[model samples]
Target: MTRIPHEMSGEPNPLRALTLDRLRSRTSMKWRAYPEDVLPLWVAEMDVPLAEPIVRSLTDALELGDTGYPAGTGYAEALAGFAEKRWGWEVAVERTAIVPDVMLGVVEMLKLVTGPGDPVVVNSPVYPPFYMFVEHMDREVVEAPLGADLRIDFDALDETFRRATTGGRRAAFLLCSPHNPTGTVHTADELAAVAALADRHGVRVVADEIHAPVTAGGVDFVPYLRLPGAENGLSLMSASKAWNLAGLKAALAIAGPAAAADLDRMPEEVSHGPSHLGIIAHSAALRYGTDWLDALLAGLDDNRRLLVDLLAEHLPVITHRPGEATYLAWLDCRALGLGDDPADVFLRRGRVALSSGIPFGTGGAGHVRLNLATSPELLTEGVRRMAAALD
Candidate 1:
């Protein structure tokens, strides 16, 4: 496969630059999970090629035989620099720990704050893993379902937090910043309110910010720790989602000032999970992949608009509100007369696989999450297939 060069003026949109023949040749789950007839847009993986800097960094490591256990603050430092520059948020390097990936980091963070059988709060119509991981750890998941607008519902959150902490029992809230499926980016005010509520109820907060770098232009992505009263919060961040490095597993678990000691309690063996090559690739992406990320975001923005137009032209009954971040679109398809899981129908009838809404919990019923990170041709075909499923 010919490598697409870094984003440049006159360059085709990265999302549109790749061809179906080239994409189908790949072996990733997105390609292999379905037969050639099925357009697989169900997973969060982006179809873009790796950024030049990441490729160069990994290549140099392999050629030099530098593959070994990771042993430095380089990844953390790179993420700190990226955070400071991108969001004007300062990250105290000493307060961060390298984890295997965002989900594992979240699991470790939850372990620090809650015991088995303790309640973990999540905003539903959320990433399904939030339920799976927490339950796997023997913890209970409590839902504070997102409001009708797909944004956080403060009243529901407050009540849920109150219930989770009844009788002075400890609890944790797993926050999905720039949320998945729905792609609702929580505002600063909303986060501040969350901090106040968590503080009031004695519930610890852990945020998954894997999609931080994928926000559309003009949207401010706020770090949870940046809010006052949130000094006890923890956040799991990674470049995997934005840079298409899911195969490379490395992430940072950032601690708020007050939670530094809690993070210090994480077992040493947990740090051994990340691959050295993963660290190298993630560090390169954070340190030097800004231009490529910006270009990808531009392509994603175009794809978002393209999806809106396509859906309107074909699947007119489906309602989509474009999110400010992430490439996933949360679509409401109840009016189409499809049952609870529309994705099943689309896949069986039209051979276009989408994320089933039922697995996402609560408001996920009668909805489907569409990934918008592919070329215009593929996205259009996916939409067309979805529409044909109705016939």
Candidate 2:
């Protein structure tokens, strides 16, 4: 049966516009890691409260409160169901294993598949972790700087992989889907190109898909496992970013027969150490989050447009692509004349906290990533501050 797409009902809900209220209503505002007084348009966490359904599920679980080790597909089942429902993809329930977070999955995969000194090709100006994970493992990290449009430099990718393979650095690429900081959603063809390259070089693809579920607009995010050579490589998936449950420390590593045995390389003790509560929260989030996700994605579209309009009217020199994923706006702030790091200037002068661009590595120096998962009032206020600082 063919299903018709559904849209949210009746103008926007006012309840949805309450991040500023939440911020103001807090009586005992401690010094937030995100900083106080200055509105945080920085962290990836949405400023909104948890989806009611998720809150209920977690509340119910806490009421039961076993706080013991989680077992069976009891936890991952929600995640598996979500995959089938949302993406039309089926993951073998048994093959999936829990990890504390997506980065751990990447690190573990890097440790398992490559030697100590192997090279990992990361697309530059990419997620900072893409560089850090390889470096932490003492791996040779090669940079594939992004192109003018901020999409992967397929040409640079070709060169990096070729050199890594030829020089016998034994290359493996960390592929970021619906890439972070820049928010470019890689199309199936784009992902296919990546997979083809990895396959040709016999490089494993440790695809970090933490932000896969929150793509903006007409952009479609193809999971690396859904790409051509996915079975030949490894893919990581998590609900942390999509559901704002990063505190839960729940993520999964999805592998096919090609990379199945690699999980064996991790010590038995650490595999067992992931929190039961985190796993339960993960299950609840994945199972009950569809409606909330739909609402949130809709909210993000509004937020993205607001930023574009505000930037156009107030900060005209700044250029931005409508965030195609992850609700983060990548702004070209170099035109505004603050030398080197501009996010710092936005914070110091604008009184608005935003992600610094340089930490995203190569080709990202002149940009600052704006996080838009907040109430319109705060977002508007943030823009006002930015404009004042610049002017």
Candidate 3:
């Protein structure tokens, strides 16, 4: 494998804030899932400290006893500002509504666009929740597996879109930009092709862009709504993933120009789920957290290169296709000869926890997803444990 030179941003490593001792003391799912001796690298939660701006905002809100119900468009406006500044995308703040989080917002948008039992399209080896929540909503899922190159298979997507919209059913496509597990950032041309295909099939698109801000390694994240033929699509976004504010629970659902009326059809109850404190925290993140985010990105760049070197030296049999974005690394463990579910063996023998790939549906066997958003010391130890497990 060719080595890519590491890029430095000269900022302090924000990830250094969380030492292994500090992380183990927390009670989050990632830390609580395994025994004390096991190293947890399964979940998407970043092992980093909160951005100072977000901390300050939440503290100020609590000091004034301002824990009333969420109101107004603070979250939407903040997102609009961030979008324009970062992606050069013009977001219609007035056309956006606050929802509890990205998943709930996607479900609500799916309800607005497609009926029960209607077909929904997704790329396989996707985020696990894409399968769970869509089934819970009584929707039929059509899989368009990513190509051998680990990017969206346009040919497969075309075929799946046709099957999904068969008989003129009101189908919806759930798009994960800066895709999880693989971390493939979809390009503008690819998004435009998706727009054209959706237009042809008369299907509505709901993009889960929660990972937009964390795109690293010289890749640019293009918002789906910014495409030429994407005026009818809807986007679900939040600062939760990038800013490590998932527990706060705030997200936005923005509509394209032609879909503004459809957003109005969203039930009033949907807007009530977002927390007022969450809005303040998320708003502050978009408004003032860019420097911290940049520093985190620089640190993540270092981690990515470090993992490449570690795998080459310690676990040469396992191949990692470095993703253009996100901290997750998809490991092809087929060569390890550990059978289909290697994560189970690693957990028991290596005392290291990781996400099993089979749960991601078709084409997931013989793979594992490893989270790299930890201190360098912990990351080094985790890889060492996996190597020892093989021995």
Candidate 4:
């Protein structure tokens, strides 16, 4: 696990220097979803190269012909190391289990905490899959819309929790730390309050902290389980989001002290869903990819700031209040008068694709989630096209 020194790293800008032509040549969903003419800024995927450690680990696995079912606690140990080093959080390897991906892990955790037809609380304008997967499990969704500042509205959350558990039915709260589509990272105070409310209402909190390592600038991402009264919570984490290893498909489900019993009850077959190669890649990432992650985070910080300037210079009417985490930018498009779905208009007129906000549930209409995890040139061009669409 040799770490690369910052001065020795040769790339002038690891993420910003990429050209559109180079990116368009690839066949990923972001590139293939639209015509060559359109700039794809809709998906959460980054346009950067894979981390060296992950590449090396995957190549080694392939060369050795060692691709089989995943085994051992190496992935969990690597995660524990990363958590201790990065967040000062200690993970008990025994209480953690591997899953195919973060969303699937959440689904399983919800099943363990609540029965089918039970209520699950979530914040509105959240990750689209939160709504989709909860409904897919025959569970009801309870929305607690984020406040105007794009942070958690504790009052709304308490009310939603009360409503969800009114029937003496236990509910599960699916929390998205450093919330998606808005990039709002929850503060320690905010998370502690959430724990208090959930504790009072006898609700189980399952935190999706997949974006924990990618937090930008100086924002402190509070892992939900670390707060007081959070001993009953479950957290889903992955190296995929930060290291651009989504295709590898590995994630971890961790349980707090009180919730360890619930995690222990999860079916053994659920662990079989993880890919062996995916585990290897993710383990390598946590153990050896910190430098690469640091560089990527630096680039993301720049892109977020660059977006503010781009929006001001090009699409003045579109207001972007930059959040402290994630490469996603939530743009307020109400002033543009693009009807209920601005993404549709942008795709047809501007040749620029953005994630439609409508699917993120209430408070999402008149908005679009733009992916800023690409090169500066491509990001600038996307904004330029979006501006031209207005004409």
Candidate 5:
């Protein structure tokens, strides 16, 4: 692996803010000719390509591709190994199954674990998919919006759980670790609190750790299953985001003995044949993708510092609480009068695309989720456009 030299400049790292020179391809924002057409800072995907080792592994797999039915099996072991190696969580390979994606795992769990008319609770201003999954499943979507700082509202959660119990509502909690939009990584204390609530209500819990790998330092993310009552619950994970393999549909559904039996009872052919390519890509990522993860983390750490410091200086009106995880930056654009449609204004007027806060629920109303996974140049350009738009 080749190491790139970086300078801190006593002032601030340019890599910390955003830069465009780290172009991954001709079509991405980095090298695209008419980048002014759209500076995409909305999607969770990074403009950077997959790490070199991951790339090499997939390239080798394609070379051996016969287009024949892939052995796409052995995925559970791969996930189990990765989990044990990364977080010291002892997940048994037998207790795992492959879902096409993390959100799919949520959908499938809804199908099997939740009943129609059952209430599903989620922290508001969360990943929109959690909202969609419940609504699409015909289950009730219950919102437990975060507190003033946008961290989980423990009191509200307790009250909601009690009311659900009193009102004959069996509710399931979908907890997002290294939470989306806000980027508050739920700590073990938070997880334990939620676990106690779920245990009291007999409501199952599913912890979504899809953005597990990219959490900035100084933040701690507890594996949902590692919580006290988590053994009876479930933990959702994936290598796609960390490995830049989102296009490759492969994720893991991990549970303890009881939950494992439930998953085993699922159709024998749940993950039989998949995008042969996805399987090949997923396998390699789990097996040979760690080193690249280290380098990516370094780059992301720099980008995060840049966003935080720049927000403090030039865009004072736009306050940033800083993220604990993921490449997403949650910005407080409310003070700038950037308009109720701040994200839209940024996209249409400033030529920078970003995730709208409204869809993330009430707490995120005047906020915006900006993608910081792109090059430092692109991030800087987007931030520059944002500063100009606000002033």
Candidate 6:
């Protein structure tokens, strides 16, 4: 029951401040999915305490027996405030709808713009769920694999969009902003190019901006809706990733001016999927969790740099390009000769669990994603175990 110090009181690095013993005590998927012998760094969950404001808000709500169906526009308003302050982007609250979570929100947004069996394009080696949920909904997933540098491949994308929307058929482009696995934060120009292409091909853009707030090293995150050509685009956002509130399932589906009508068509029953408490917690984090988030970003930056040193020193064969956003590191293990799924080798031989890259679709092979949101000690140990697998 050790309390984490407030970031304002000068706790420099939250990642280093936490201990493995404390992290292992939690029952979250990141820890419980594997045995104690294996260091669990596979999932998106971070090893950090709840921001004090979020805890206090939820506690106060419970003490008052305030648990009921979500109401009002508090969550949307809070998000708007946070977006304006952090990214200098203004969110139109009237055009936002709350849904269960980012993935579910993406599904709902897709449904708004597409139909069953219609094509949905994604940048491959992206988030696995983007492929799963879209396919589960009976939509076709067209892969426009990223370029060698892991940024958008415009030529491929333009051609894919043409193929997807043939015969005047409608398609949706599922964009992962500040993308997952690789953590490439799309620049303003890149996003603008995507908007232009989506418009030209008559494809609706549905951006999964769940990782927006986690950008590090002074990178600017441009919301898709903020661009001029993105007037028809929709974006799904949540405080879950940045604030580690994944258990509390709530997210906002924001629509650009031209797409407001489509967003409004979302079934009203879909609103019930989000927990009232989740709304409160997410809202509190958006409104009052800025200081804690800043500290977390700083700590993640530290780990990002530390991972570079650790990989170079211990596992020189793995190629890691540190992304400007997200606490996940995409490691290229092709040189290790561990076959397509290196995570399997690492887990079976080295007893350390990491995410296998196969499920992430095209360009995922010979790669493994390591969660770097934990203490430096655990990260170092994880790399050491990964190296041991090669031996």
* Model 4, span 153-206: residue lDDT tens: 899999999999997998999999979989998988889899999999999999
Q: Give the TM-score of candidate 6.
A: 0.97
What do the candidate models score in CA lDDT, each in turn?
A: 0.91, 0.76, 0.90, 0.89, 0.73, 0.91
Q: Which stretches of candidate 2 lie over 4 Å from their true place?
A: 1-21, 24-31
TM-score of each: 0.97, 0.93, 0.97, 0.96, 0.89, 0.97
**Model 1, span 104-187: residue lDDT tens:** 999999999999999999999899999999999999999999999889999999999999999999999999998998888899
For candidate 6, lDDT tens digit of each residue in 1-391? 1222223434356676668888888988988988889999899999888888999999999999999999889999999989988787889999999999999999999998999999999999989998889999999999999999999999999999999999999999999998998999999999999999998999999999999988876677889999999999999999999999999999999999999999999999999999999999999999998888888987888889999999999998789999989889999999988899999999999999999999999999999999999988888899898888878
What's the CA RMSD of model 6 in angstroms?
3.6
Worst 10 contiguous positions by lDDT, candidate 3: 1-10
Q: Please identify which of the two predictions, 1 or 5, would achieve the higher TM-score against the true structure.
A: 1
Residues 1-391 of candidate 3: C-alpha lDDT, one tens digit per residue: 1212224334467778877888899999999989999999999899999988999999999999999999999888899888887888888888999999999999999998999999989888999999999999999888899998889999999888888877887899999898888989999999999999999989899999999988775677899999999999999999998898889999999999999988999999889999999999999999988878888888888888889999999999898887788889999999999998999989999999999999897878999999999888888999999999988
Q: What value does the lDDT take at residue 119 in candidate 3?
A: 90
Over 262-354, each residue of candidate 2 has an lDDT whose tens digit, in order, gives 765666655575677777777777876666777777778888888888988999899888868887888888888887688888888888888
The order of the candidates by lDDT, greatest first, is 6, 1, 3, 4, 2, 5
Error of 3 at 376 (Å): 1.0
Candidate 6 structure lDDT: 0.91
Clashing residue pairs in candidate 6, if any? none
Q: Clashes in candidate 5: how many?
A: 12
How far out, in Å, is residue 266 in model 5? 2.5
